[model samples]
Target chain A: MAIPLIQFINVSKNFGESHVLKGLNLSIYKGEITAVIGKSGTGKSVLLKHIIGLVQQDSGQILIEGQPLSQLSPKKIKLFYQKLSYMFQDNALFDFMNIYDNIALPLVENSRFPKDQVNKKVLKRMDQLGLIDIEKKFPSQLSGGMRKRVALARALVMDPEIVLFDEPTTGLDPIRKKKVHSMIQEYQKKFEFTAVIVSHDIPEIFNVVQRIALLDDGIIKFEGTKKDILDSQSKILNDFIAGKDI
Target chain B: MLNKLIEKFGEKTINLLKSFGRIILFCFSGVTNIFTLPFQFAKIIEHMWFIGTKSIFVIILTGLFTGMVLGLQGYYSLVKVGSEAALGAAVSLTLISELGPVFTAIMVTARAGSSMAAEIGVMRISEQIDALKTMHINPVRFLFSPRIIAAAISFPLLTALFDVVGIFGGFISGSMMLGINKHVYMDTVIQSVKIHDINVGFYKAFAFALVTTTICCYRGYYTHLYSGFGARGVSLSTTNAVVHSCIAIFIFDYIITFFWV
Candidate 1:
């Protein structure tokens, strides 16, 4: 039980009359890849958002490393952000910035690192991700897979302790999907950071995440290891495992 | 049929009111967030370059041409009234009271406002805004404030540039093109255009800057209200940003004039 790095305690959220998350309770252990799987609009991404205090739960608590998110002031929240990174579904690189600048933004904004150091660090990360050639290219110029890798590189640039991935393989082809999954695994191993991934692509994610949480109708219907997910007799889990309506 | 129509219209009107209310609330919260956060001088400089330096050429070109046209038109109209010497006064007054602020605002709304909406809209769609929140970064301070502050500072300066260039254009037209005495043209402008006229333009520019930035940021900030993604949504937000900001500028301009006069 290594003091679960993140916890959602009966967290709930509603968008108007429609509830997105319903009394959800889950904990994410450090250095583990936790996959949140559900059909579209089942609040997988919303749950990931709550963990990082992106969206406050309507009536519950979210704790990161034993500290409640709501209690932290805005300044403290910014400090907390330094320890977390997010990989957006669309790889939301500032289109105005070149890839090198995009990856260097957090460092330049938050860290005490000077320009030369930021450049060196960015180039080193880019090299690790095989993105050295596209350093000057904007996000629009990169392929979907390349964009995802660049986003991952940017997320890792700060050496964050937690990384949230929102649909890392949504629009990619099978080859690219595999590549993204492998990248996720590689980064998780190298950084030893808690990785919380939201994706409907269960099969691909199953190969990477240590544990899986199945969300249905705004609730966590089941939570267990990959073996438990594969062996479950629950109908909702069955449909999900069978790749029906995913 | 009348009842049904009233119901439909009532619903739409209420929704519109709600939207307006939300925009005001968002602006207030954004302002508060900016104050709550620690000042980042580097971010301010980055935005000044983006919002001010980048927009200079367009603003200058727009101002120059507007002045020239105003001068030519005013000269002809004053001549028709047998007061051709009043050309400079009319041109200067109109530029300072109206064109300088209004046209500059419209240009900014089209150039920066639309892009602001699109940028934030994309961030909304991509959940980068959420990422910021999760990272404990107030999107307002991180994203919105810089633009608002930049626009606030730039709009008045740009409007002054517009007035200067416009007045010069009028001088050039009255003296060189219309064959009016340079002294007469200069005297009319000096006599009629008081400090208050320039002050009015500056005030309006400030108001327009606030209106345009608020509308654009509000439109983009709450983009989740819109369903769907891709080019259509982005285009819708861009149009909304420009149109709403323009309308807001005009509406505020009227309000300010009502008081300032």
Candidate 2:
């Protein structure tokens, strides 16, 4: 059996009177695409946030490679964070910075690479993503799909081991949504990076995601491969996959 | 009814105090980040150009007119007392001790401070700040520290420019327009203005810089917490930044004057 790369053990979170995550336990394996599907406001995004250390869990522990995150020393924690990347729902590209600068920001802020080297790395990544002749254009100048690509380029520029995507295809047409899913699948294969996506695309998402975790009422109600989910006896889980509200 | 009234008032008071405490902590974070390694020198320079260099024309225009008005008014009042020859002393003293720093700060608050709030509020609402955090960068250090440092450097320079241009403006009204001796006007300004007055102006400029930039940036950085979400949030933050900074400048100016005097 493969050891999980990241694990959430009986974690919980509450925002005032509303409890978001309750005694949730999950594990993310290395180099696979896992999609967290849930109804709106069911703490799907919160789960992703906890994985990236944006929002800390109120209780329980998150372990990375069998070592608890809270127990890691400051130096180890810094190294741990360097191995993760996030793609926000809105892309969150710096509107003030052009394409070149936006993609190069992580390298510039985190590394001692020289100007030419940064340029070479950024240019190569942009070229591979087919982002040509738009280095000077700001994020606002790009179309929604193009902006998504730019954001993915920025996320991959650091060569992180895990990438968390929060609703990568919200507010897109069906074709664009399919394109985004394919893009994620293609990149996940090419880079061999672990992916955890929060999505609501229903059956469209099942095609790309190898594993599905159905969250309900502050806990993950189901977790398994697509075949296992289809073969399960839980009616609510089947309804959820059919785009029905539980 | 009486118990409910008291409870309401108490709640409001506690909330206000909590807000004040948070503002203080936010300011401390921004100032402390300046000493942190890999200081944002380039960003600071860019902001200085935006806040200081871009503001030269407006500062000059206001300063010149203010000096001219002081000369004219001082002439009328001093003429009544038969001491109109002291016009140079009067004009330079008013500008150097008080008007230059206060007016320059107000102008900058209106122009740069408001924009700072709006821009940061947008970034907060849009979660660009969070993106910075995910990249292992401190958002406050990246976004707020540069503006703070730039404002600190720019305010005193702008105040000095205001004083110099103001004195020259007084020359136009007192010596050139009103036909007072040019040498006498220039001589009185040079002779009567003490180093103490200049020092007070610079100190006030520095203090105002801290008060205005801190308030503006704090309001913007915590826009989500303060003003709900979206365009309304950004709008409210900008309004609060401008209003609070103006009020703070006046209050701080009075405090500084009380101590100096």
Candidate 3:
């Protein structure tokens, strides 16, 4: 088998008496979409954060392309983060910034791009995401779906090596969710970067993802292709697929 | 019972020491990042606008009224002692050496200090700080250094402005109202004032600015480390920041002034 693009080795995290992640191990390959589907509060988002160094695990380790993230120097870590991007669940857009500046931030902050080029890049991404002429509007002025799209635009504007989406389609309507799923597919096809999406939106996300990892009790209880998950005899996987809690 | 009291006292002392250590460390990190790679000129300018320009009007009003009051009281007392001509010395000395920096700092603590806390507190609660971190931007450099630098720079200037405006206020009340000649009053002020007094006021102002901003920023920046009340947490941080800034201002003022005395 090929070397895994990202690896979690027996990682554990605890908040006081409660353990959020308990010796979880998983591997993600390059150029693939892997959706971590689990019930709310199962440490799915925590695992995604560890990948990008947002949150640290209490034990074990996380490796990105065979380089241990915990061991990287500050300079190297920042340089590493330039190649990785995360789209927050809150859209985390600066409230004071307009949509254009919001989308333009990751580029402008990380690089010394000229004003006109920055504008062009931001406008291009906005157009690709169907966010035309709304540059002057603040995040507060935009609807939830529009805000998420603007946030995603900021994430992709960097053209990173790995893109992590946290609950990408959580609050959107069915049509908006469908539109977002299509956008992800379209962009993933164009960019071909590794994608790890943390979501509880199960069957809805299943069709859009190539692989599925079922997280339960702070561990990856099941990991395989959608067909394998569907054909498996695991009670938890079956309950998850049938929209019932186990 | 006495042992319990002693034990409780020891625990409280350790906790207080830890908090002080934390603030010093936070200040160290913030100051170091401010001088580190790629300083932000634009954000610094914006912060100066917020901390300096927006604060001038209220400082002017307070300075003028305070000077006038000092002038009125001083003129009355001097007239009783048949030393009404000494009114200029009293007003200028008090305004420059003591009240000017102290009042200006208190006003700013109420105005800009609390707002800085609220702004950073909101950013912390909302995860904008995390967003900056993920984008490889240091939150201390990007969010903090500018405001701290702005307050330090603006406080001394505002204290000087307060001194000037207050002298004019005293001039009006002492000369125009109490019938002391403008020329004699001006001469008295020029003669009585020394450069050391003004310098001391500014040094104190600079020190107070650093203290107030550091306390407010540290308190607000670490709101998440406080109890998790979500919106309530940010609000509490803001309130505590303002309160702490005031307390730190007085404590540092005494410490700095004690050295002078």
Q: lDDT of all the models against the reference? A: 0.82, 0.91, 0.87
True contacts kept of each: 0.55, 0.66, 0.72
- The candidates, ranked best first by TM-score, are 3, 2, 1
Q: Comparing to the true complex, what docking class would candidate 3 get?
A: medium
Best by DockQ: 2
In order, what DockQ does each candidate have? 0.44, 0.76, 0.74
Model 2, position B8: C-alpha lDDT score: 100
> Runs in model 3 with CA error above 4 Å?
A72-76, B1-11, B227-229
Which pairs clash in the backbone of model 3?
Answer: none
C-alpha positional error of residue A119 in candidate 3 after TM-score superposition, expressed in Å: 2.0
Task: Estimate, for each residue in B107-180, the C-alpha lDDT of model 3 and write its tens digit.
Answer: 99889988888888888888888888777777887778888788888999999999999999999999988889
Q: For each candidate, what is chain B's TM-score?
A: 0.94, 0.97, 0.94
Best by lDDT: 2
| Ranked by lDDT, top first | 2, 3, 1
Please report, as a residue range, the 10-residue window in candidate 2 chain A with the lowest summed lDDT: A236-245
Across all models, the iRMS values in order are 2.5, 0.7, 1.0
Candidate 1, residues A1-246: lDDT per residue as tens digits? 567778888888998899998898888888999998888878887887676656778998887678887887888766676678888777777777899888887786665788889988999989887787888899899887788878888888888888989888877788878877897899789879889999877577889999998888888888988889768888878877787763
Task: Give, for candidate 3 chain A, the lowest lDDT window spanning 10 residues.
Answer: A106-115
